[model samples]
Structures are given as structure tokens and as C-alpha cells.
Target chain A: MKNNFRNSKLLVIEDNSDHRFFIEKAMKTCLSEVSAIHMSTEQQAIAYMDSCLYQEWDLPTLILLDLYLPNRENGWRILEHIRQMPTPINQIPIVMLSYSNQRDDIAEAYQKGISSYLVKPTHEEEWVSYFQKLRSYWWETVTLPKMRFSF
Target chain B: MKNNFRNSKLLVIEDNSDHRFFIEKAMKTCLSEVSAIHMSTEQQAIAYMDSCLYQEWDLPTLILLDLYLPNRENGWRILEHIRQMPTPINQIPIVMLSYSNQRDDIAEAYQKGISSYLVKPTHEEEWVSYFQKLRSYWWETVTLPKMRFSF
Candidate 1:
């Protein structure tokens, strides 16, 4: 059998250029072959997601959502929009990656139904370690639904 | 500050007593300190969850659901039930453990919003490794919403 994740793509929604640079760097180091799309704002994310619905596009295998685009509320807004998308699109696992460890933010993220919440690391090396664990779980250990279907 | 998971509890809902035994054994070997509650039937699972609402019961930090109580449809039934429960109760991450790897089953499990899908290992040693990866992701690396809230 061939590798199931040969074409897996990760969609990252993060606005901070610094964080975005680190995310791509980490993915390149940890899971080099997994292509990623970084949308720096809520509007870009919505437009790209909407475009996927209309055009022949390969929907992302997983989503990494940054909890704030200057405001945490925007995180909730984009998450709601994605969750409300049709069928398997909504089913795509959205792991929230945020710098905030505030109880209210974590609690509310769960209340609104994020697949998992990860506290963003501070240093570049720590970011690599973070993605290593992320890769170990999502890529190596668990079976992802995205590998099996497309429309 | 105290360890957040000081009082964390795991809820395992499996109809097979044999599988139940293995799961418990794995938890002890890997995460001995975390208390576990195992329910052997769908009714028991529902009763336990419902009772938590009225009593001073501790809500499970994580739920491990057996794909079938002899039939796969039962997994969906119980999952939908739990997903509809009130507030943070519905927010608890439910990891579906199953022997079936049918594309349809995996796809539908995601469609229904399972936190993740794991394939049940056939050997005792493999089960431990499975739980090890599980522990690595869910326990050590990621920040679960469960550790932070209560009704």
C-alpha cells in the first residue's frame, strides 16, 4: 500500500509574521513534505475557505488556528465560520495554537468546540519541539479522516 | 502553583469486558496516577454521564469510547448523545477507539465530531505503545481544556 498522507496539506491561520515564519520553519524541520498554506487574516482565511467550496481545490488535512488576530474574538468568529461549513469541511480538525494560557481563553475555546488547544512556545527551538510532538501524534500515531476522502 | 491535572479522571466506555480489562491495564502501566472509570454498557455510560449533572461527580477529563457495543451504530448513538449535553460537558474531547478501519467508519466518525479516531491494537504490547503515543500527545504535550474547568 502507498503512503496515505502523500498529499496532506496543513492550513495555518496566523496573522503575526514572526509566528508565521516560525511555523513554516518548524514544519519544514519536523514534517518537511507536508505543504502548508498560511492565511494572515480572517478575511483571507474566509476567502480561501470559500474558494475551496466553489473551485476544485484540495481542502486542508488539518487546520492550525491562531487564537488572536490582535483580538481573541476574531478567533471565535473564524472558528464558527469553519465549523458551520458543509459536511467533512466542518469535520476537519481545528487545533487552536495560541500564546495565551488564560483560563478564560482555553475554557471558551473548548466551549466553542476546538479539537485541541496548544500554547504557543516562546523560542524557536521550543517551537520545533512543539511541532515534533504535534507531528508524532497527528502524523505518526492517529488516523486522520482527511486521508480517506475528498469532494 | 499546583499541578493542574492533580485530580484528573478518565472515563472509558467499552462494552467488551476483555477490552475493558486491557484498557485499564494500559492506563495503570502508563498513567497510573490518573483515576479511571470504566462503564461496560451504553446505558451505564449514559447513566453515569447524566448523574454527573445532578451529583457532585467529577466530569471526565477525557473519554475513550468503544466503536461498537457489538454494533458500530451504537458508537454513533452514544456519541451524538454526549455531544448534545449541556455546556462544557459537551466540550470534553472524545477519542473513538475501534477495531474497524473501514474508510466509511473513519470518515463518519470525523463527520460526527470525534476528537480523534484510534485503531485498537490486537496485541498486549502494541496496546501499551498505543497508549504511550496517546499519553505523549494528550497528556504531556497538548493543553487539554479538561484540566481547567468545572460546572
Candidate 2:
């Protein structure tokens, strides 16, 4: 598949450092020219989004969010907040990447408006394959919303 | 990837007969055992959904929606109506597949809460590739919410 995500910027809100690193690395490998903004906490992510709104910064093409945060149930809250925002900001696709495979958690995330839910793989090889498939589908096949910088 | 979607059903809302056939064919080719329900208009889709609800029939795992419909601007309306429905029904992932690649259309669909927006490709080879990628990503890699029959 062609690198359709060469110029895309992605926002990843993952608390685990190792996971964040792997995701960033995988995304970079998947897309020739990609800029990924990583956030380890809910507050940081909110602050970044707020700043982007206030400063008219270009919004990320996609958001990869972790379900379980370090010390709070903030993933769902964050998703709800984004969905409640005005216009284009609310339109950004949020894909939940979590270890929880419980039906309740999956149902709850979809109910909260996650674009898709992916179960985090335990094996490193599985992670690689998962990200590769993700890159192929989302970046190559899906037509992501064009982020307009003008407000 | 294992056939996680063996017993799953898919709801396809498209006005064109050719598109519906192709989608159904592609999905069947991708998944070993998949039942796809096709509707040509918004009214039909709504009636089908209502019947499924009333009859306690199994809801679809995914919805492939067309942006333009016959005689009305019903795509967004249908999406909004589904989202307003009670819990599990509203949680069904709606993927918008349209020929229109307009930024406004894409942005509007996402704002209306479509899980993903894919531009309907004209070429047969492209459609095959798209459906293959879609099946791999959604059916195999992603965790779909379990459809609960009981309200």
C-alpha cells in the first residue's frame, strides 16, 4: 500500500512509556513522514488540546487513546469531552487501545463514541502485526477528515 | 486471522444496487460466514432497524452507510436517529462510504458520529483491496461490542 499518511500528525494518549514508544516507532515506520504527539496523563492531554484550540494549531488527524489511565477513569471522560466540543474538533476520530477485553468495557467505549476499539496485544510480534494492520487500514484505506486550520 | 465475525450480521444502507451487491460479495469473501442485510433507502433502513428492535432480532455488528440517498438528505438523518436510539443499538459502529470526497461532507459525517468515513472506490481492484483491509482491521483486529438481544 502507498504511504497515504506521509503528512499526517497523530495524537497518542498512552500512559505507559513503553507502549507509547512502540506506537511512535511503529507509526513512524508505517508512515514516511509522520509527526506524533505523545501524552502520558489526562491533564497533559487536555491541556494540549486546549492549547491547540486557543492557538489555532492544526489538530491531529487521529487520536489513539488508552482506556485505563494511571490513577483515574479519565479515558471515557476525555472521549466525552472531545465529542462534546464544537464542530471539527468534535469530529476527530478517537480509537481506543486498551488491554481490557471485557464486554462491558468494549460496550462502554463504543457507547462513549470511540471510532474503534483495539485490544492491546501481549506479545511484541503481535503488537507489530496489529500496528501494521492498523496502518494499512486507517491510513491507506480510510478517508480521514481534512483538518482545517482556519477557525 | 480467525473468523471472529462468523456469526455476525452486517447492515448495508446504499441506494445503488451495484454497490450493495459488491459490498455484500466482498464482505462474504472476506468473512467465512457473514449475513448482510441490504436497504436501498433511509425509510427501509429505519423500518428494518425498528423491526429488529421490536422483534428482538440480533442487531448488526456494523453498518455501512451511503452518504447520498434517493429523494432526500437522509444519510445524516439516519445516523442521527440511530445515535439517539437506546444504548446498544446506538453503539453499533456506522462506517460512511460515499463517492463524495468533499471536506464538508467528511467533516459533517464525522461530526454526526460515524465510526469511519471511506471514499467509495470506482475500480473493482480497489474495492477488493479496500474490503480486504476492512475485514482484516475491523473483523480480525478490532473488538466489536457484543450484541445483546435483551433490552
Candidate 3:
């Protein structure tokens, strides 16, 4: 696959340290230019988003969120918070990266307006291919909303 | 990429005949087994979904919707109608395919709960690659929600 995702920012909210490291490594290896920001807790993620709004910072191109988090609100709550944001801020794509393949979780995520739901792969090779295909689809095939930052 | 999409159904609601043909052809070419059902009007799409509910028929794995349709309700209206459906049906992924790259359109589509927004490629090669990447991402990398048909 071609690398069309250069210079794109990806914000990931994952509680597990190993999963976070794997995702960051896979994304950086797969995309030509990727700035993957990690937040281990829901509070941190929300705080980061608030700071972005306050500073008028450019929002990440995509958000990789874990369904279950430790010591804070879960991914569903985060999804709701983002969706309630005004205008373009609410339009950013959010893909849920969780281990839960439960029917209720999948249904709820879609209903909550997730861009996509992906079950994390178990093996290392699978993760590599997963990130590769994801980058190809989002960067090459999809037309993301043009982010408008109010000056 | 693995052909995990065998026997999967895709409902396409597009007004333009040429675009429909291209999408169907591309999907068929990329996936090992794909049933691409085309609906030119919004009414037909609704009718199909209703039939699936009434007859306990297998719903499509993904819905390819056009933002602007020739007759009846547009894509946004259709999206709203689907999202209001009960349970699993509402969970079906809806991807908007449009020639319009307007910021308003993209933002509105995402806000209304589209899974992804894709700009229709102008060239044939681009369409082929687009479908290939989309199939790889959705069928291989992502775990789609299990459809529940109430008899």
C-alpha cells in the first residue's frame, strides 16, 4: 500500500501500556509521517481535547479509543462528549479499538456515532497488517472533513 | 488481503447509473464474494430495509449511500431514518459516496452518523484502488457487528 498518511496526527486513548506501545509503533512504521499521541486515562483524553479547543490547536485526523478505560469514564462517554462538540470539532473520525467483540458493545458504539469499530488483533503480525490497511483506507480512500479552527 | 467478506451483502443507494455500475464492478472485482444491491431512489432503499425487517431477511453488511439523490428523501434523511431503527439494523455501517467535497456536506454527514464519507473517484483506476482498500479495511481489519433478525 502507498503511504498517503504523511504528517497526519492520531490521538489514541488506550489504558494498557503494551497496547499503547504496539499501536504507536505500528502506526509510525506503517505511515510515512504519523504523530501518535497517547492518553492512558479518560480524564487525560478529555483534558487534551479541551486544551485543543482552548488553544485553537489542530485536531487529530483520527482518534483511536479503547472501549474500557481505567480510573475514568469509558470510551462510550468520550464518544458522546466528542459528538456533542460544536460543528467541525464534532466531525472528527473516531474508530474504537477494543478487545470486546460483544454484540451490545458493537451496537452501542455504532449508535453512539463511531466512525468504525475494530477489534484489536492478538498477534504481532496481525497488528502490522491492521494498521497498514487502516492507514490505506482512511488516508487514501476516505475524504475526512476539513477541520476549521476558529482563530 | 484476506477474503473475509464472502457472502456479504452491500446495499447501494445511488441515483447515477454509471456510478452504481462502477461501484458494483469494483466491489465484485476486489472481494471474493459480494452481493451488491443497487437502489436508485431513497424510497427503494427504505423499502428494501423494511422488507429485510418484515421477512427476516439477511441485512446488508454495509450501506453505500449517495448524499444527493434524484427522487424522494436525500441521504441525510435516509441516514436519520435508519439510525432511528431498532437495534442491529441501525448498527449497519453507512458510508456516504459523493462527488461534492464541500465542508458543510462532510460535517453534516458525520454529524448525522455516517460511518465514513468517501469522495467518488474521477478515474477508473482510483475507483478500483478505493474499493480494494475499503474492502481490506472493513472486511479484514474490522469486525462487523453480528446482525440480529427478529422473526
Ordered list by TM-score, greatest first: 2, 3, 1
Q: What TM-score does model 3 achieve against the real structure? A: 0.92
The TM-score between candidate 1 and the true structure equals 0.91
For model 2, the interface Cα RMSD in angstroms equals 0.7
The local lDDT score (0 to 100) that residue A130 gets in candidate 2 is 79
Q: Candidates 1 and 2: which is better by TM-score?
A: 2
For every model in order, the TM-score on chain A comes to: 0.92, 0.89, 0.90
List the global CA lDDT of all models.
0.80, 0.80, 0.79
Off by over 4 Å in 2: A1-6, B1-3, B149-151
Give the 10-residue window scoring lowest on summed lDDT in candidate 2 chain A.
A1-10
State the displacement of the C-alpha of residue A24, model 3, in Å, after optimal TM-score superposition. 1.8
* Candidate 1 residue-wise lDDT at B39: 86
User: For candidate 2, lDDT tens digit of each residue in A1-151?
Assistant: 4344645777889999888777866776665465788888888888877776765455777889998986337887788888887667888899999988888998999998999999898876677787788778778788887666632
The C-alpha local distance difference test score for the whole of candidate 2 amounts to: 0.80
Report lDDT (Cα) of residue A109, candidate 2: 94
- Any residue pairs clashing in model 2, and if so which? none
True contacts kept of 2: 0.96
DockQ of 3: 0.79
